[model samples]
Target chain A: MGRGMKRWMLWLPLAVFALLFAVVAAGLFRPADRTVRSAMIGKPIPNFTLPGMVPGKPGLATATLTAGRPHLVNVFASWCVPCIAEAPQLMRLKAMGVPIEGIAIRDTREDLLGFLRRNGDPYERIGDDQRSAVQVALGSSGVPESFVVDGAGTIVLQHVGDIRAEDVDDIAAAVRNAK
Target chain B: MAALCIALAAPVLADPSTPPAALAYTQLRDPAQEATAKALMETLRCLVCQGQSIADSDASLAGDMRSLVRERIAKGENPASIRAWLIQRYGDYVTYDPPLSAVTWPLWLAPIVLLAVGALLARQSFRRRPR
Candidate 1:
């Protein structure tokens, strides 16, 4: 082997190690996107009429979603902690004249009542997704996910995880764009 | 060891008449149909657990998925159609067997490419060795 080629071969192990370390470190620091972006986005909302979760509030349905106005559909549960965390933002969105509907996943009537009482009810219509069929149909994997639906009933944007204070503006903007 | 073995085998030894606890967890009565559904379930990824297939996961979503698969299979729907339905709703992430796509072609090619490079390097090193 030539002197230069032999020297290069001697450093090959170190070079390989460094390259491997760089790839691993990059992965460690900036982890793969764990959030599942719903494939249902841009697709029209599936047809279903969910019974009202709480008395006096209306039940949710695809017909209502497509009723000539943009709105927000929030998938939440009384048992989920993050749902409680995002309650304030939901209320803020409601205050901003955003039409917010809710899907209560696997929650009991009593629990739903209690959750609403504790965290002021921001929902105009609350649907009981007792078996999460609607949630699965919407491609929602977890509680506290929200989607912006346009007047045409098409899903415009999906916001996974809890809505923080900062997300309020973005969500409002999405709803506006849908209009 | 004897006690541990008994503990592990306890479930199998339990009374068969005990009704299934969850609707979704219940297996089909027909062995052939159940077998087909189970096979398909093993190839489905659990959205909640991420690492576990729906068959191996105890997550409620997995159970729901299992129920959907079993119900569809009982209706004489083929596994491919059922898989397609789930992929449509949840995207390709739900399946363990990913189809070739623009983004995923590299994943399928990487192993063969790596092996070819390794073989070429091995040949070059062998030729350079002092006899």
Candidate 2:
């Protein structure tokens, strides 16, 4: 190889290494989003009618979601620890007049009642999702997930994980926008 | 020796936490239908346990998914249609095999482009110089 070509070849390895380093550094600095954003957003809520988990409270149905007001649908279970953590925040939202609905996944009545008694019951309607059929149909993968449904029954937002104090405002904003 | 073997096998036989199999986890009676459902399940990514496919994951959600797949397949729905249904519900993330879309086109093209570049460079370097 000529002197110029040899000089170019000498830098090629360093160039390749720098390119890889840059890629790695970029990834470290700006990590890829690991959260799965549900595709069901902007789509109408799936049709489902679950039985009442708590007595006297009516069961949740697709028609109830379209009751001409935006509301929050929370998927939780007595077995999920995060549900307890989010309970206070859910109560806060309920007090704010954000009508909240509940889907109790794979939970018994006794456990659910105890959980509500210990924390606080803010749900307007609590549905029993014994087999996670409604949860799966809603594209919810885990407990403590919440969705903001507009008056038209379209899902405006899907918030995975527990509703922390910090997330309350954002969720409220989403609920408002859904209106 | 027998005691040691029994001790080792005891743990295997005493899995108390294993949940009862869901309705769909039970294979279809017809071997052909079961095979078809199994093949489709292997391609579905479990939303709960992201690492394992629905066929391999023991998550209750995966079982539910497996049941849905088996039921649909048994109803004579093709695997492609079932896959489409899942993709529609969960987006492209639910399938191990993502179809080529505008965002994924670069991934499909990069290998061929890289190979062509390498071949061109190799030819230039190894070509015999005119005497």
Candidate 3:
């Protein structure tokens, strides 16, 4: 190879490495605001009216969840281990008299009922979302996600992971602010 | 390559549960090999869809991986040995849940170490620079 060709080959790998580094950096450090903005702030609450776990009983409907009062909506699944971890925290929220609604995504009736029976039912009403239509509407990446809806039915805040005791205060504050 | 093309085209032409008519004529119809192929595909990563397994992804690369897995299984390679071969070729990046070991130390600890170093450097630089 000529001296010029040798110089080009050295630069080619360097250019490739630089391009790869840039792509990886972009993946790692892309703006969190853009990724989460739609779900967390100023998005309309998800509209859904799914059948309840019980055959005959009236299932929870999104129409029942209104903009008239501040409410919390929890998205959980029976298969999700983290949902189990957050069950007691949800019960604590119920004990504190917080109005909590639940959206059960892609889970069987038996599994959902089993979950409720094992962990005390904190949900005022629950929606059975087997197809994840509500999840798509809410733009959720995964469960367990929680949304705080304002009196105007706007989703004001969202939590992506299991709720801890510290998060209770923030959620309560959002609920108060929503009201 | 012809057999691979047939296998690749099989699922697209017919329902997955139904064996392809073309494949029905072949003497290499081994159920164990089919299972091994499926298992390997499920375990492999789809490079295009980083979050999806090769079996779950609809990407062309996933299709290629599926075809490759099928060919290896048909060649009488065990699924475990095939998996080991892939791990050697691509490292643990091919597996979604890589085993925790010295190889994974950077992935597990880089963030904390980066943060600590950044904090220390920030303190030192800011102290000297009067920012």
Q: How high is the CA lDDT of each candidate model? A: 0.88, 0.85, 0.70
Ranking by TM-score: 2, 1, 3
Q: Write the per-residue lDDT of candidate 2 for residues A31-129, one digit (tens) a residue.
A: 987676677888999999999979889889999998789999999887787888999999999888899999988777888888899999999999987
Q: Candidate 3, residues A119-176: lDDT per residue as tens digits?
A: 8788877887655556545655456889888887888887877898788888877887
Which model, 1 or 3, shows the larger DockQ?
Answer: 1
How do the residues A1-179 of candidate 1 rate in per-residue lDDT, one tens digit apiece?
69999899899999999999999999999999988778999999999999996889989999999888999999998878888899999999999999999998777788789889999899999998776778888998887899999999999999999999999999999998997
Off by over 4 Å in 2: A1-3, B1-21, B118-131
Docking class of 2: acceptable
Tell me the lDDT of model 1 at B52: 97
Candidate that beats the other on TM-score, 2 or 3, i.e. the better one: 2
Residue range B18-128, candidate 3, lDDT tens digits: 222222223236887776677667777765566789788764335545655666678788877867655643456676656668888788789999999799868977887
TM-score on alpha carbons, each prediction = 0.84, 0.84, 0.50
Question: Which ten residues in a row are the worst by lDDT in model 2 chain A?
Answer: A32-41
Q: Write the per-residue lDDT of candidate 1 for residues B80-118, one digit (tens) a residue.
A: 999988888889998998889997899899999999999
Selected candidate, larger lDDT, 1 vs 2: 1
Error of 3 at B6 (Å): 40
lDDT of 3 at A11: 93
